[model samples]
Structure formats: structure tokens, C-alpha cells
Target: MEMTFPDAAPPFLADAGWAGAAIEPIPGDASARRYFRLRRENGTAMLMHAPPPGEDPEPFLRAARWLDANGLRAPQILAEDTGAGLVLLQDFGEVRMREYLDAWPQDEREVYAHAVDALIQLHQLPPGPFTQYSLAEYQREARLFIDWFCPVQGLYVDLKSWTEAWEEVLGPLLARQRPGVTVLRDYHAENIMLDGGLDRQGLLDFQDALVGHPAYDLVSLLQDARRDVDPVTERAMLEHYITQSGAGPHFAEDYARLGAQRNAKIIGIFVRLWQRDGKPRYLDYIPRVWALLERDLAHPALAPVARWFDAHVPAALRDPTGRLGGTFAV
Candidate 1:
């Protein structure tokens, strides 16, 4: 993909005395946003270029400010150009928690505990500026599986029955909670940095934060699609969060519900990244995501949705290579 920089340096960068800072492209995630590490003799900074139509920095700025105020380590904004979707920010260093855990598997427990602590801190914030994660939103995201995943397998399953089944599964769960905790919509290891200078967990890519049930972020973290957080760590983290947060007895069910819902949505997202976004590598993760989804489906609360899946989506559809070739690429 072509990297588009402003005609000149962003005025904000120039104003911040970064006129001759060396520009280095930082790897981006699944989003359109790009980051560059700008280094100079005195200091280092990050330039975020999230070009417009869909990539606005306003919401990110607001959320970062709220988090920083509440004693979390969201990057401090040095400068911004909302018109150009540019932001100059504090550099959070190189090691993502994912990479850290890969290098030192023994530290998984300690690292994940801090991640849990970060969530505990985050959820404690007074309901801030964020949209509610409504049932409509959940259903819409779940439909991505039907929209994108089906086409790859040469099938078109009408999602009316699926949505109806979801209503049966999610209706009670949604009613059990409203917009209470600030859910960092994407809280996986990839978005979390391990910068000891700031906070133990350095938060990133929270531009899509929402006011929702706490279990959603927990699901995102423990049931990560990109990396396997082992069963022991996963169980310990859940118990720790419940103990720390004082969530009631039904917390486990809520976690399972959101975990199922999230994994279901991600199945389509990975497929869509290939079919629509022209990024085929994500297809490799389909099986891992399916495995996680199947586990969540085993929850008793998911019986209705599980029956729907068993009836409609066959076993072949669950495994990426069962019907579609493992080398399936568009």
C-alpha cells in the first residue's frame, strides 16, 4: 500500500521542532491507521497518519485524554491535525505485550495480571464519552460471518434465522447489563504495550472505545484470536478480574456470552479482510478463531445459538480447510 504523507511536514510536527527528525514507518495493525517513529538527537516521537473518509483522530484523542486523566497510560498528545488525520504522540517503545510474552513465557501470569489491573482501572472510570454497545450493534457485527465468511466457501446462508437465534442467545445477556463500564473495544495483547516508564500496561488503538459491559474487554484479552493465552492463565485471569471487580455470580456467563459473540464476529472479520480488504493472510487464523468459537458455543447459555449453528453451518464451514482449500486465496 502507498504511504501518503502531507504535502509538507504536518505543521504540528514542524511546530514541535521535529523539522529534521528521521522518519521510520512503524508496522500497522488491521486498521487504516499508520504510525511512524520520528527520532531526533534529543527525543523520539510517533507520528500517526490515519487518512480520512473513515479514519478520524478526534474520537481517539477524546478517549486518550479520558484515560490519561484517569491514571492510565494512553499516549500523551504532542500535536494533532484533525483535518489531515495526523497526530504526534509520545513514543511507547518497541515491545508489545505479545512479543514480550513470546520471549518470556514464564512471565505470562505477571503480565496478564497487569493487563487485568489495567482493565480494572479502566472499568472504574465514570461512564465517559462513548456509545452504548447495543443489541443492534452486536447483531450487526455477528452478521459479518454470514456476509463475508459464507461467500468464500461458496455458500449463502440467509442470516434471518441466525439473527433470530442470536436474539434468543443474547436477549437475556443484553438485558442483564447496560452501558456501565468503559470497554476498550479492542483490548488484545497486540494493542497493549509494555512500557514500564508510564503505566505497566500502555494502551493503544482505543479509538473505538465504548460504554459497555466489562466482560467484553475481558473476552477480547483472554480469548485473543492472534495468540493463545493458555487455559491456566485464562482461568486465573478470569478469577482475578471477578475478585478484583466484585462482579456477581453471573459474571462467568456474561464472559462466555460476550466471548461467543466476539469470536463469531471475528470469524467474518478475518474473512472480510481477505475478500473485501484484499488482505489474505488473515485467512490463516480462521481455524483458531473457530476453535475458540466452538468452545464458547459449549456454554449452556449459548445452546440456542449452538443449535442454530449445528443446523445451518455444517462442520465443513467451521474448519477453514474442510471445504475451502487450506491454500484458499482470492
Candidate 2:
């Protein structure tokens, strides 16, 4: 189905002085927000349409300003009409980190190192004006597994125990992250733009930024849902971040804990995307995410969550194929 511009788009663009630009639609992710590349004779910009009720542009604007002010490379907002849910932004061009590494896999180490360095620099600063990723928030996200994935599989597990397990496991994790660093929740290869080379990575999709653990974003990067990061590269970049950032000795445990919580959230999210939102393509990533989650669960920190999974979600039902009725769409 073709996606049409919202009723407020034309005037919004015109008022932003982009009335006559050639508009090219960019592919969308799971969100309702739509993006367009606006090419005028002089230059180009990105047009974001985040229609209200389901999406909002204020958080994006806030995070973008904070990141740009902090010397990170977020897109410069050219103009915005928050009421109309439209924003004009400086174009970062097409070379993203994922595609760059795809063409030159040898560049993986270099690019990942640069990303880790960026995170190190980001963590040094105080967190932006955003809510902290509190224990409740982590629990809320983790419960997506119970809310979406479990019911779809017809497994009526103990919700009370699920809650207790997450609380027990995550309480200490949150305790260690007090007065936390800025965590760009969706930080990953796809959201990073190679605008001006690897030294200056352009950040995208950071509207959901929060004050949280530093290790969370690293997990998002190394255990990315859309692509497979080699285990060696994952470990190397992790150690690189720890050594360079002067993180605590327990950083590895924190990484495992966050990785498990994050993977569980993503599993529920992907399942919700397919079953509730009618986009089945996300289902393709479930098995990979399960693998990552399983590895994280093996860590002693996640023993409670691991036990819950052992009783409720068996290894057979862990993959989408087991309960999704057959082979998933490619």
C-alpha cells in the first residue's frame, strides 16, 4: 500500500521554505512515522511526518538538540511544526554504518571501534533532559514478553512469578546505574550514519533516549536485531569500551543483565509488530534474538529470568517457528 502524506504536510513544508523540493519517500520501520528526502536545487533535507496520537516529534526534537549541543552528530533541525507533526532536517546522506560494513566487512572493526569511542565520549557528559530508565520502565519493557509473546503461543504462564523474577534480577542492575548516563535505546548499526566518515557518526532514531546504564546501548549495538555481528567483533568492542571508558569490574555482569532484558523486550516487540501491527517481516529476527537472549540468560545474573523461561517458555517454543504455525516469511 502506498503511504500518502498527511493533510498537514504541504503547508508545513511550504512554511518551512521547502514548497517546491522533490520529495522521495524513505522506507519506514515499525513506527508510524514516515520520512521523505526533500531535494531542492541548492541542497537537501529530511522531512519527518510523525502524526499525532500514535507518534510525537517533541522527544526527537529534544534529543536531537541535546546530542547536537553535546558535539554528537544528530541531524540539524531546519524547521518544525510540532502541531502538524512535521519537521525539516539536514540530510545526512545515504551511507549508514550497516551498509558501509556490508560492502567492506574488513571495516567492521574500525567502524565498531569508532562507535564505542563515541559512546565513551557520550557517557562522560551528564545525561540529557529525559526520564531515567527506572526499574519500573525496565519491568514495563520486559513484560512485553508476557503481554504479547506468551499469549500468542497459548502458554498461560505465571505472571506473578514473571514480575518477581524481573524485579529480583533488575533491582541490583538499576542500583548500580544510579545517576546514569544517556542511553540511546535504539543505538545500533542501522541507526548510525557515516556522515563525514567514521570519526563523526550521525545518530538517528534516538527519540527514545533515556538516562540509563551505559552498557544498554552497547548491547543494542553488538546484539543488533537486523544484522549479525560476529562474536569476536562483539567481544572485542565490548572489552574496548570497558577498557577505554574505565568502567567498573562488574561491567560485564551489567552487560549480561541489560542484554537479557533488552533481548526479551525486543522479542515481545517483534512479536507485537507481527501479530498486532500486521507487519510480519519483523518475525524473521526472532530466532536470532532468542539466541542472544539464551546466551544472556546463561549468565548468573539472570538466573531468576532463566528459571522463569525454563518453566514457561521451553527451548522448542523459544523460536517463532515453534508456535508461529510454520516457517516464517523470509
Task: Identify the leading candidate in terms of TM-score.
Answer: 2
lDDT of 2 by residue, 1-330 (tens): 246876887888888888978989999878999998999899999998898878899999999999999998899999999988889898999999999989999889999999989999999999889999998899899999989888877778887999999999888878778789999999999899997887779899999999999999999999998888999999999999999999998899999999999999998999899887888988888888988998899999999999999988867777533354563442
Quote each prediction's TM-score.
0.95, 0.96
Best by lDDT: 2
- What candidate 2 gets wrong by more than 4 Å, as runs, is 319-330
Clashes (N, CA, C under 3 Å) per candidate: 0, 0
- Residue 219 miss distance in model 2 (angstroms): 0.6
Off by over 4 Å in 1: 8-10, 197-199, 320-324
